[model samples]
Target: MLQRSPKDDTGDFLFHFSSIKIYNEHTLVAAPMGSGVYVRHKEGDWEGLRQGMPEDVHVNRLIIQTGKLFACTNKGLFEFDMICELWRDTGLVIGCYQLREAGGQLWAATPYGLWSRTGTGWHKIAYSHVRVYDFLFYPEFIILALEFGIAVYDRLVGVWMEFPFNEAVTGLAVFEGHILGVTENGTLLHGDKQGGFEQIRFPHLFLFSIVTKGSEVYACSDRGLFRISCIRDQITLISVRLGCPVTDIDCNADNLYMATLFQGIQRLEL
Candidate 1:
């Protein structure tokens, strides 16, 4: 188990981390506001790998595609060069918020729109007006949780479908065989393509992100981390109250990492 605070660790290096992404079982990356990126290589140690990045960079999201590390930041889409241990811009001028890998491509959620990168170029697929907060990918469709509602992109028909909700959405996930979304006010919503959305009475916290492990669903908010379970269309909070304002969460089979607004990154034994 890792200690909560190590003595050799200085405050300057562990800046306010926003996101955590695990590339493999033992490798992970932490995105910080001003400290570029910190990569935990396997089980050995964590190293700073921001040789060419800006000193005051805000890495909003981190993702891995084709065995390479990529970051979504205020600048644009960046790919980490493992050879030289530096970050290279992918020429996409996007102030991105979230990133996902689907259909052999990289999808980025930005204020402008949702951009997809297949080869070397980026293309705007849909939702040019709605500001996207998060995204989820399934076999037949892509769900994008917008600032106001949720948008579904039908891959078979090559069209977009809208499920409008009045409340602003903060996160999206595929849970319990349904499309699930969390509102800014921490209400859990399940979407039906023909029936619209129904609000689940979970909690009234400001939820930011949602992740899943097996059948269990986890949500992070200003209050803490909550474990939710959905059975027979009824959602129940199984466990909660972990750490402060968890901005992002990622986990492997053995360990889970949480990134907070103030506490850098916290490791939990799973």
Candidate 2:
């Protein structure tokens, strides 16, 4: 069992681990914010940082690289140094939505376009005409989720191919060739890069966040949270209260971490 820390705690706020990066130290850094971020050494170890940050700013997303934490804030891009205990402002684009590491590089979703960091520089991932939301890279291709729908980035052809998703995407998670996307009105949209998309039918799930443990995919919905197997095809209720407007859902090898709008953060023993 992990001991809880006084400072590393949460109240009533939405928490979703839509993005996670594990360090060499086994410390998992998660972006639990739709408008901010935090780091924890373990459960009950929440530390509010923005320590050396210049002013009050809201960070939408974050990514970790080279033993440092990087984020796109309302002000601009920033890197957090744990050793020096300081926040270094990158001062790049001010309108960034999300960040991910792919193909030995860091990729961020900016209002301008998709920005990729290679070594010490950043170049735009040109899309003909679209605002990219979320992305996941595989050995073969890269998948991008947008407001319009879900698309795949072809590194070979240098083009984007939009998959036939007819609804707006709220959140997405990639596992192998399959991508799980949550849509409005409590529907789960899943698509395979090789095959096509197939909606997994369930009860009244509010559809907030999507998470995966091995091949088991979990969904946070208004009605409640449900866990479904990739091959077994069984939808099991995880939690009802923890499902509504759920902010962050993260796991540390064992046990579960959940953050909700009404509930600050909840830990499940199993």
Candidate No. with top TM-score: 1
Q: What RMSD, rounded to one decimal, does every model reach? A: 2.9, 4.5
Clashing pairs in 1: none
- Model 1: residue 144 alpha-carbon error in angstroms: 1.5
TM per candidate: 0.84, 0.73
Candidate 1: tens digits of C-alpha lDDT, residues 83-191: 7878888777767777877877788888877888867588887786767878888788888888888888888998888777787776787765677898877778876
lDDT of 2: 0.61
The clash count of every prediction, one per candidate, is 0, 12
TM-score quality measure for candidate 2? 0.73
Give the Cα lDDT of each candidate: 0.75, 0.61
The most accurate candidate by lDDT is 1
Model 2 / residue 129 / CA error / Å? 4.0
